[model samples]
Target: MSNRSRANRPTPDLSDANNPHAQKAQNFGPSAKRLFGILGQDKNTLIVVFIFSVLSVGLTVLGPWLLGKATNVVFEGFLSKQFPEGTTKDLVIAQLQAQGDTNQASMLENMNLVPGSGIDFDRLASILLLVLGAYLLGSIFSLIQARILNRIVQDAMNRLRIQVEEKIHRLPLSYFDSIKRGDLLSRVTNDVDNIGQSLQQTLSQAITSLLTVIGVLVMMFIISPLLALVALVSIPITIAITVVVAKRSQKLFTDQWKQTGVLNARVEETYSGHAVVKVFGHQKDVQEAFDEENDSVYKASFGAQFVSGIIMPSMMFVGNLSYVAIAVVGGLQVASGSLSIGAVQSFIQYSRQFTQPLSQLGSMANLLQSGVASAERVFELLDEKEQDPDPLTPATVAHSANRLEFKDVSFGYTEDNTLISNLNLEVRSGSTIAIVGPTGAGKTTLVNLIMRFYDINEGSLTLGNTADSAIDVRTMTRADLRSRTGMVLQDTWLFAGTIRENILYGRPDATEEDMVAAARAAYVDRFVHALPDGYDTVLDDEAVNLSVGERQLITIARAFLANPRLLILDEATSSVDTRTELLIQRAMSKLRQDRTAFVIAHRLSTIRDANLILMMEHGEIVEHGNHRELMEKQGAYWTLYNSQFQAPAQHESQTDGDHI
Candidate 1:
């Protein structure tokens, strides 16, 4: 894809019900279900959680009914006209018996009906206490449910994070080449974080809301079926609005996160190359690009929020309509003596409870969709094609034998485009071969192949002597192959840890004495003693505390500690100063003594004493000879060497002419 298309692609509507991606998500279903399946691994915890949730819902549902009983106690006490002031209990009982109102008499007796109008405060108190206790118990269960669910969610997230880390190690280097570091980091950090947060906050609420709706509906039906039907009138309408808005909002959310990824990439690029941006005075352009991405994210977010924001108010309007219908119909029922006043009150509460959860779920549509999008990205990364699967019943190769050859090797970043073709090379055991090439001459490509960072599409790379049929390198596990080789790249990488930890990275089992010896060999000890913490000094993300040359030396010390049978150094000293380069060269020479080393250097003067010189261009070795032999031929190697050695003198003469 061109940079223009990459930067300016229009935001997609991921929420369109007809959108393929959205439909695909529906087809595959939410990752939440898969996550829940992961939770199924702990069936005991799930059962306990389910029990608590049910207990909480049952207690909550019983509250309104218990409260209605209290209301009836107060209502009947105030409305009883049969008991007039100064009327005796015997007269009231006789009057009730004459009227044949046995049920009313029983209710009056149970209430401890006073001659004068008054409420049964003691009974009211008892019912109120029961209501309070039920609520308190319900809250306790709710808390337990939340805590247990949190444990399950966090444990699942932890497992997912570990899997992602392991998956990264299993992926091929080409995967990293095609993806931005920031984008990949976002998947592991931001995307996974999204999933965890959604599960923690939304998952439990979703369950509770669903239970509340069901429990409320049942209560509403029990009170008065006619009024219950009135309340049910809004269900289809609210669902209609929810589905329409959710679909549209889903698309917006996907675009929002896509823009977020772009913005992250922009920030990473600008910050990592801040010096270059300033040097070229391209700060304006960089800022403009960032603003574009930032604006896009803002717009996408606004659209998503605007659409999702409609769910609550729309549902509220529908809920209020339902409330009106229920109240009017319930009042009629009460007036006709078909329903008690207390029942009417309880039914109204249930009606509201029913709508409350629907509103909550409607609001959650946005969160659910966003979480789903993040999960899709994360799952995509997890499901990516890994480096060639480890052979079943894997085999190991012998160490300390570094005779290597590449036969008819053909490879490329993409299959259709072959960069290296029909390449053939052989190196004797324990020989130092220096590779000299210009920019984009496939220098590092060759080194990468040697390290098996990439596999060739055609032909074979073999180790051991060809005399008795060579052993194909692919037969051995990648870990075993790389363990016996040490590499020092031009771009030094050090983790944020103590200097000692970074040095010990190469050989974790190396002793302190061995670490010190390797540091001294690489000349890293010279600067280590100068730092305030000596070997304990810490490094940050950029490792800015150490100079370029200092960082390079530490990496060299790392390679030295590994003491591999084969060494690959790709422009190891290219970024250092003259004095530091000389020191690094001396260190490398010592390290390369017994190993078969492949050194890629642009400086022709540094490899004069190499056992063999392979001058490469356009993925092919154009010349092969030692210094004197190549000089005698005056070919490509000769031209490259003189260009470097004689450039300064040629510039001096040009300057002299200009002065004259």
Candidate 2:
């Protein structure tokens, strides 16, 4: 599939959805919106699980009602003689008949509570069994719903993690240059992890707590609306307190995450560059830097947690006050013969059920806020633009002997500083072209443009003969373009894998014979065979086990294996010893055969056989010609060659031509 198609596919926007700062208020409307969105993603599972949750909530209410009924049954048996001496039995029968207005009462009466009555003990045992069964069924439903919700959250997090990773891969390289590696890492790792945790712990619990509150309020109103109204007065007060605390906590959590990123960056830098620190005897300096960052992280985290911590206790205080108010009012009503003891008991239970979830929800507000902070960072990354759009409908390329051409190309990373302007060049197929210049002459930038790592700001680059037939690099797929190009750089990077794997990285489907041939050509086979495991030896981190020269050889071998139509060797032999440089030069000679090659080298001797040499200065070509033609001109090329290359040779000759 095309890279564009792969990138455009719909994925979870975890960052946007989870951002704490983005959520304005903790109202039921917004919470329900988020909840429904999550559920809508997998409606089938949500529907089934929601049904089970409702059944569980309904059954939970039945347990309290059943207990109340059983309590009344016990009280009636004791009060039977208080009704009237002779009419006691009649009164008892009348009470039972009145209570048997519901199906549950009928079920209860079948067990028989009348004194001296032939009550069936077996039936009573069965009624007790039914009560136990109801409780167990409710517990089972709760467990099932909890598990399903947890799975939904986990799956959503998984999808979000994958989306962030894909965005990172597709984002422009320039974006990374402007952003800290540690900060990006924190967003993907730390932020996403927080979201997952919040979903698992806070999200499911919040839902259950909300349902509990609603169910309890309904029950409370049924028993006594006057008492319920008194209890509910504390809600607005509690919410006001929660809102103020949540606002402060959100800011603190955001600051905490920012500080965490800074700390992570400092730690990563210190560890990664430990060798440099020790070599420079800067251990104390590094330690102080680390301590500063660590202190920042600690302070920010402590303040955020401390501020958020106040919410739970505050909620409890409000809840306790509300509870006392309900009790005082309820007791007065019962004393005045306006309420029953059973109704009072049920109302108190419902009040506790109502306030308990609200308190728990308050406690989890901080975690939810932290998750939001994380989401903001993740979304920022996802929203970044990709390097350049690949062609929606690309033009086909037919085989041709056409040369690569740069026509009045001007480029810059940013608008204020132009690297190269009105630059023009031509590189024929199967020709060796050398680009020689002083430092910062845009040599590497030119190479980057050729590979389409960055597009030029102005002008055009053509790959064919006719300007009308020229193909834009952006119009071609990156994978296809990269497959046709090969590069070997000064700082060779070998991934942590076997030597065989590193060499075959460019062409995973290559035959073993092809790999061996490429390795032999790149002169990498000599070192490989000398190792204990030959090509099977695994490389360590950064390939520190291999010498710099050996790493260069491996990279060269990779290029050879790919066998691209175009080759770029950017100071490939600069860091090696004389003998190794010779080996690399020999490998380059073979690799450059029948391919268009661009060589960027500091050493002038390496490019003496180039078909054409372009001498550059200040991001512009000053002179261009072959070795003899440049020497004959006695111009900029001659001046550079005599000073930089010839003077070194003359000095060496005076020292008996030492091989360097």
Best by TM-score: 1
Cα lDDT computed for each candidate against the true fold: 0.82, 0.75
Tens digit of lDDT per residue, candidate 1, span 599-651?
A: 88888888998888998877788998788899899999999999997999999
Query: Which regions in candidate 2 have their CA more than 4 angstroms from the true location?
Result: 1-39, 78-131, 399-402, 465-469, 631-660
lDDT agreement of model 2 with the native: 0.75
Over the stretch 1-660, how does candidate 2's per-residue lDDT look in tens digits?
111111212222212546432233343334435534654687788787778887777777666655554544454444443445444454555565687644323333333245443334454455466667778998899899999988888888888888898898787655655555676678789988987887688866787788788888888888788998998898998899889998888877877887777677677767877998999999999899889878877998999999999999999999899999999998877655466555677677778778889999999988887777666666666667787767788654544424578889988777777777899887777888898877767777787888877788998777754556667666677766666788888777788899999999979999999999999987888888888799999998688878888898888899999988789888888767898788778778878887888988878888999998988776688889998999899988788778886687888798884554
Q: List the residue pairs that clash in candidate 1.
A: 14-251, 15-251
